[model samples]
Target: MRPDLTEPLKLLAVRVERVLEQVLPTPELEPSRLHAAMRYSVLGGGKRLRPLLCYAGAAAVGGRTEQADRAAAALEVIHAYSLIHDDLPAMDDDDLRRGKPTCHIAFDEATAILAGDALQALAFELIANDPGHSTERSRLAAIRTLALACGSQGMAGGQAFDLGAVGRQLTEFELKRMHAHKTGALIRAAVLMGAELTGQADSHQLAQLARFGSLVGLAFQIRDDILDIEGDTEIIGKRQGADIARNKPTFPSIMGLDAAKAAAEDTRQQALSALSSFGPEAELLRDLAHYAVDRPS
Candidate 1:
């Protein structure tokens, strides 16, 4: 049985929020509108799952939360920037996010675009200047991990595949590869970044964490596909069946709902198994694996 994560997750959320609030520029700053938009995009919204995964990875290796904060903050900023860009008219064209108006919808399109660009820059700056990093090598490694994850070969590449796949039926292999890059890359980076911050994870340990990240990443997208089919538009904060409307290739669209659900379950099991080498300190990570599949939004 899964351990209860309610209190622990809430605590982590609060902790992460504090770190974000400190790092993000305030609305009073020059270029106030843009700064405000950036703050609005990052604060007081969404599940912060990526940061949570970062924290959980650190915990699994018996690392302190403080050590994970800069990485978590940087990754979350990148995630926020991606969401802003993904919601643009040229991309997913989403109007709503987390049940609120998307950045482009709430603010002007140009400002929204600029805000995303700034946030992306800030993410790298934070990683580069992180005082918590014990060495220049570690800091550079983290920066490289994030850059590769968000670059054309990773998230951006996946988004390109998704755009090309609309209205076209893709094989399961192709679909998985697309999401692995699009949705899974950053998630995988989050886990790896957390483990790396500990400076305690050995090669074998990092390998295990990588496997866990990959499994959870796939499972996360599979669950999102399921929700697009069965979830309420209001609850999901987007149009129900949006992917279907776009004719995008998703797990359920390719394999049927039952099969997609089974796939998520199988992936979840694999994620859990990857943590077998970890001790009780890994309970948060295990709970997060379950949350990835079980969350309603």
Candidate 2:
């Protein structure tokens, strides 16, 4: 049996909205061109899953949700930047995202690239320069967290792998490995950042949160793989067959549909187990485990 952790997942999305409003700059301010691009992309909107994960991680350890806001906002910025670049003509050449025009389509490709670059820098600056976080040391650590998640070892590396894998046969493990870096890295860091916001988290508890993050992170990709096959573009927002069209290796392609669903279930179970030590303290985390896989997109 598993704990009925429902609230943790419920609170995060709302919190994410507040965080975005707080961190994203006002349009009236100077550097208006850059700010317009920054707001255009970051505020353009998506699921905001990464930010929710950050709050969930903090809440699991009894940290205040507001304390995790900066981290969540920063992660969203990085995520938004990745999307901007991913849709460029040189990359996926995607025209639609979240049911709207891609940045490069709505704006110019050059502007889109510049906006992504600026948002990446802004994410780091948000963490390193946040006064509310209360300590330069902690802020610096947050910077490190975002850097590793977004850089060579994480999102960037994942994209590189994806680019190289086109029209190739990749094993299930290889498919998993690609997503682990591309999407999972930042997710894990989001959870850790939540703990960091609380001043300090017990090492044992932190380990458990990392485990929770890892399980959900992978599950997220597996579910995504399944959805790409079975979901509609209306709900997924992006085109449904894009992965197949690109010849990307998906769980369904390698493991079969039933196996992919089973894998997602197993990952969700493991995610729940990771929060066992938190007992009811991880209620939101528990809810998220179910929600992550169950979500249509």
Candidate 3:
């Protein structure tokens, strides 16, 4: 039977929240509105899956959760920034996020954009100046990992593919490629960053972890696509059928719902397979792979 992750996940999430609170600018600071919007965009909502993956990755390499905190915080900040931009009027024009008004909806468009930009800059700053890093090289590696994930070849590139693919029929391979960058890149970074921070995982172990992260990332997107079709807006924290409404390409749209579900499971199995070399140390990572598909939202 799978170990119950309810308590562990909750604890890790709280840890992330505390770290974010410490690192993010207080709403009372000068440029108060921008600071408030940044805090609002980051603080109170959404599943902190990326950060959890970072912790799990560290654990898989026999590192402690405390050691992974900076990387975890940085990943979530980047994620929050991405969500803010993705919800803008020029993008998805989303009104809801984490069941609250999106940044652009809660604040003016310019403020929302600035909030995202500031958060993006802050993410790198956190990673670059992480005092926990034993060596400058390790810190730089973490920074490079995050930068590549957020840059033209990673999440941003994937979003570009998504925007361009709207209302167009794409092959399964093409769809997977798009999501691989958009959703998978950051997730991969989270896991890799966790392992990298420890300075423990050798290249071979890192390779296996990367494989695990990639498969789990694909599973995550497939489950999200399925949820977009079957989940209630209140439960999923976003508009149900939003993808269909936008005619966005999705696994379900290309392969059918049942097929998409099966694909998610298969991808989850592949993720587990990638961890075959690991022992009990990787149980948390395995549980995360399951959670990626089994989560209700």
lDDT of each: 0.89, 0.82, 0.91
Give the alpha carbon lDDT tens digit for every residue of 176-239 in model 2: 8889898998888888888877767888987888888888999988888888999999888899
Q: Summarize candidate 1's per-residue lDDT along 15-59 as a digit string, tens digits.
A: 889999999999888999999999999999878888999999888
TM-score of each: 0.96, 0.93, 0.97
Deviation in angstroms for 73 in model 1? 1.0
| Among all candidates shown, the one with the greatest TM-score | 3
lDDT of 2: 0.82
Q: How many residue pairs clash in each candidate?
A: 0, 1, 0
Score candidate 1 by TM-score against the native. Answer: 0.96
Model 3: residue 157 alpha-carbon error in angstroms = 0.4
Clashing pairs in 3: none
Best by the lDDT measure: 3
Provide the lowest-lDDT 10-residue window in model 3.
1-10
